[model samples]
Target: DQQVKQNSPSLSVQEGRISILNCDYTNSMFDYFLWYKKYPAEGPTFLISISSIKDKNEDGRFTVFLNKSAKHLSLHIVPSQPGDSAVYFCARETSGSRLTFGEGTQLTVNP
Candidate 1:
């Protein structure tokens, strides 16, 4: 069974608006959460990450919030720019080494 899932296949946000990407997981053993952004023909780049001990982590315009009780997580991008358009993947880390990723969500930031 798929342990992680991204319900929305795509998201569209206007430039300078807030973009919210959602993810859900069924595995309780996950210890960390991460978000990755991928561009055409390039590898996914690490965006933000959160530990299970914390509910939120933020870096500049990127923030990741974890809700262990709800088995959910979200990545928020404030003031999203056109350059931010990319496919975003939500992943859970287990055993500190293995990662389970959700189906990516393509985010389009319109200028």
Candidate 2:
């Protein structure tokens, strides 16, 4: 079974709106969670991250929230832009360099 999962395969939003992406993990051993953004034919780039100890973390337009009890995490993007449209991936990192990523959630921002 996959340790991490993205429940939503895709999301569509209008420009200047909010985009919410969700993720869940079955393993409690994950120490950190990260969100990555990827474009077609390009490598994924790190977007945001939050430690297991932290309930929430925010950076500019992006915010990440972790609910340890539920083993769930969510990413929020305010004023979603067309440029922000891409495949968003949620990842869990262990003590080692290995990062387990959830199936990506594709976000489309329509103008």
Candidate 3:
């Protein structure tokens, strides 16, 4: 079974604070980890990604870390801003056709 789990459906953080989202996967075959940020009805845009070969990947304010042994991953947003408020989805690409996504975690950046 391919199941990606984001236990927290939502999270709120004050602006300029750190925001962290966690995800877990049951499938061991997953090799590509990705995080996508989405606002409202718009399609999700890629934020950062890490292959099973890497432990971490960072871009600007977004950083993702993967622990293959634990089958867990997390996304960290440093000094989050109001504009950063959105739904973050953690996904694993295994089959090459599409990614298996977590339920989603809504990050609210409070001003």
Candidate 4:
């Protein structure tokens, strides 16, 4: 069973629009949730995170909302730009120190 799932492998949207990425988890024990953004060959960079205790966290153009009851989380970007195009990965800090990551969602922003 996939503890974490990114239902869609890719998403495309026109520039200056809203881009939403969704994630679901089967494990309810995940305490720390994070979203990372990666470009091409580089490693993923931390974007936003929400603790199991909180419901939402935001940074600049990115926002991560966690609904603990539903075991779901989403990342939203507004006025999305061309530079925003990249592979986004949702990760969870499980009981183990190593992180568990989603397969990833490739976002394509049309210029």
Best by lDDT: 2
Q: List, residue by residue over 1-111, the lDDT tens digit for candidate 1.
A: 438899999999999999999999996776788899999999999999999899999999998999999999999999899999999999887775788889999999999
Q: What do the candidate models score in CA lDDT, each in turn?
A: 0.92, 0.93, 0.92, 0.90
Error of 2 at 47 (Å): 0.4
76 Cα displacement, candidate 2 (Å): 0.1
lDDT of 4 by residue, 10-104 (tens): 99999999999999999677678889999998999989888988898888989899988888999999989999899999988876657889999
Give the Cα-based TM-score of candidate 3 against the true structure. 0.95
**C-alpha positional error of residue 30 in candidate 4 after TM-score superposition, expressed in Å:** 1.6
- Candidate 2 lDDT score at position 10: 98
- Candidate 3: worst-modelled 10 consecutive residues by lDDT: 92-101
| Model 3 misplaced stretches (Cα beyond 4 Å) | none
- Output candidate 1 Cα RMSD: 1.2
Clashing pairs in 2: none
